[model samples]
Target: MIHANRWYAAATAAEISTQPTEHVICGRPLVLYRAASSGKLVALENRCPHRQAPLSMGTVVGDDIMCIYHGWVMNGAGQCVHVPHQDSVAPSVRVDAYPAVQKWGLVWLWIGDADKVDETLIPDMPWTEDANQSSVFIRFHVGANYQLMADNLLDVSHSDFLHASTFGSHAGRKAETEHVKAELDAWSEDGAVYGLRTLRDVVLSPMAAAWAGTDKPVTRTHKTCWTPPNNINIELIMENDENKVTIHHDHLMTPENETSCHYFLIWTRDFSVHSGYPTDEDVRREQSTVIGTEDISMVEAQQRNKIQFGDPADIPGAADKIVVAVHKRIAELQNEDQGLSAT
Candidate 1:
């Protein structure tokens, strides 16, 4: 089983309401809703214990949820507060309640032991909270393993080939010797692995030029960090003589199951907010075309190949250094979760 102690970004805070929202995290079905009276977000097992009906199908009344099948009321604590036909409520009649909180405009849920929930594990993205930065949020349901998505994000080499039409430039599409010359740096810290690639004085694609507000030769840096069980933050910086632009990406992947995932994406930039040069809709459309079509298509194809061929012994190259680190960290976390390690 995946480590439950880690928090997952289940849904946007605005998505939750008195009407229950159903989501699957780490292969477990969960129901999320806000209390009618208190407006506090609550998460509980989707099932109603009495008849095995989905609690999400019930109505929210004050701080409790009343089952539609029969008027059985369950509170935010997962305790059955009222049974229409009975005078006494059994203390044992309760469902599993997971700890949940609203942070960074998202509803985060902890799926493991309630007592071990760590609030610090949630990603800290001050840019998302910054009023000066204009941000765009998008969510994707990917028909692929979450690991594959994480690996794809950590490895920037694929962008040259896969994203050629959208963001790739001649500097990125070069011989292996040129690729080897790109400075590569990687490290691990605080349960995360970071990788940075610096490309010096490279030609910029049209979109990249527009985003950076420069068509001249530029120094580009691609930095990505992956935090287990599944979250990645990417920073792309393009610098020319007159202008420097930085784009921040927040990628959150929550496993819907072993073979599928929920991908939450956010793109923020400081330069374009007030300039009115590239509108949010324009950027969103470009990203949707590149990510929704190109990126997702490639990853899903890779996933299909993996499923058809099963796990194969593959050779790791210099570009795969960060990928190797990610796999090692995930294995370590899984081992720890299984009580195989003290650290």
Candidate 2:
């Protein structure tokens, strides 16, 4: 079952202007738009209840949307406000309306009971509002289950082998090996799993060196936190005695359906903020190459394998501790949401 009570990042605020946008979250089709009159963001079921036509294909008029099929109009509250050919609007003719808000440069939609929504549960992205940090946003449509992507972030040991040329370095590999052999501390708080690790005296990869402005050995700290129903934040710090660089990553995934998802990513850093050492396009290209070419390909293949052969039984290792914990937490949340006790 979907974690209906949580907020899901649907789209970037800039993407929804005067036109209606369509998004599928938690297996539900939603249409998002800003009212032309009030400029308020609104989310409603995408389909018109009359003929089952997609509301997203219709045009916006004032604070309401007109169905293209028959010119029927529905307001932001999903109330059937006007019917072109009818004398009176029936009170029962209305679609479902979802609560939506814009924060941290993104549009967030609540998929469940509106009365139960807690604003504090919306994960924070401090970098998005920080004046000292430069941020870049990108979105990807991944052909894999959202949970697989979460697992990938929880266990980043794949970087050494999967991202050899970009993020792998001899010293980084050595540090990773040692870190995997040692115990990793992961705990759950407020329905989220957080894992933190610090690797000392590690060699920096080219990308890390460029970001840190140094090629010497340094201490690297990686912190990964996963919020239920697909939200991940990663804070990476590269520090030498004199210089320190911090990169904060936000991974927001919303399920398009059972087998696919929409991945929204934001990479914010304090390195060379005003110097433009790395252009936005340059950073976008590098990240796109790594995640698009490397991670998505691998995860999609994993999904295909799962589809071909049911869930395979595999032994967990030391490096999989965090990933396993994340799965267990998800199961707990789902069970609780459905009013069932965990066995």
Candidate 3:
């Protein structure tokens, strides 16, 4: 089910260009491109009203897109402005035009009432815009439900095993896992779910150790917030007596269909922006490997099992607190959209 009246990350700013790019959100196929004249972002229903041709296959003409099937040209507002060898077109001959904007290095599209378009609803990721931060942005098409991807992120316990070689501390994996389990706290408030996990005197992984400038055990803190429509922000800090490093993780999941999703992430860190340890390329390579292989691999497998056996009634555990809270919030939003009382 899709939530209404919300902003979803359609694509990264760099992803949209003069060439029409197709992206699916909540099963709605959208064609995104920059206006040839203004260079502004434009989003329109991908399907043409005539013959149901995909607008993404068309070429951008001025501020409009011309359908290659019939030469029917549609403007940025999805209005049929020109028809080859024909007179004026009917007002009814148009597609839906969504409100789109570029912010925090991503393209955000409003999926609800145009009158209620609010840019503030977009989740904040200041680290992506900050000049002094080293950031890497990556997008993945996951063959899994968006909820499953969100579940993987909200439940931090998986890193102990799934990402043992990357994010997990090899020397102290067992102790750190136990520490996170015992100290984790999760709750929902003000239409958002939050998780706070603090691991004291925890051994850091190799990459994290390098950034923290220490191989000794340090105090690691994780603060995660999940907003509606699958947007998560994680603030992670690892500190020792001598050095501390902070990393902001922005995870955005938008449904391509009922069973597939587009996962976008931006990892920004305060260290190594100007000098010293790890370079930007190093950070990018590490994060790309970790998220692409470890996280996506597990979720895709879970999705496959879900398709074959259907959803199972499983017992909830302590690590499920944040995931549970997020599920509740999503239900509440869906209820609100349907004019039903929230459970």
Instruction: For candidate 2, report its TM-score.
Output: 0.93
lDDT of 2 by residue, 18-129 (tens): 6988888777788889999899998999989789899999999999998899999999999999998789988899999988888998988887787898878789898888
**Runs in model 2 lying further than 4 Å from the true structure:** 171-183, 339-343
Native-to-model Cα distance after best TM-score fit, residue 218 in candidate 3, in Å: 0.7
Instruction: For candidate 3, write residues 68-117 as lDDT tens digits.
Output: 89899999899999888987899999999999999998999888889999
- Candidate 2 residue pairs in clash (backbone atoms < 3 Å): none
Point out the worst 10-residue segment of candidate 1 by lDDT: 171-180
Clashes of each: 0, 0, 0
Clashes of 2: 0
lDDT value, candidate 2, whole model: 0.81
Off by over 4 Å in 1: 172-180, 339-343
Worst 10 residues of 2 by lDDT: 174-183
Which 10 successive residues of model 3 have the least lDDT summed? 171-180
What are the lDDT scores of the predictions, listed in order?
Answer: 0.82, 0.81, 0.84
What's the distance in Å from true for residue 143, model 1?
0.4
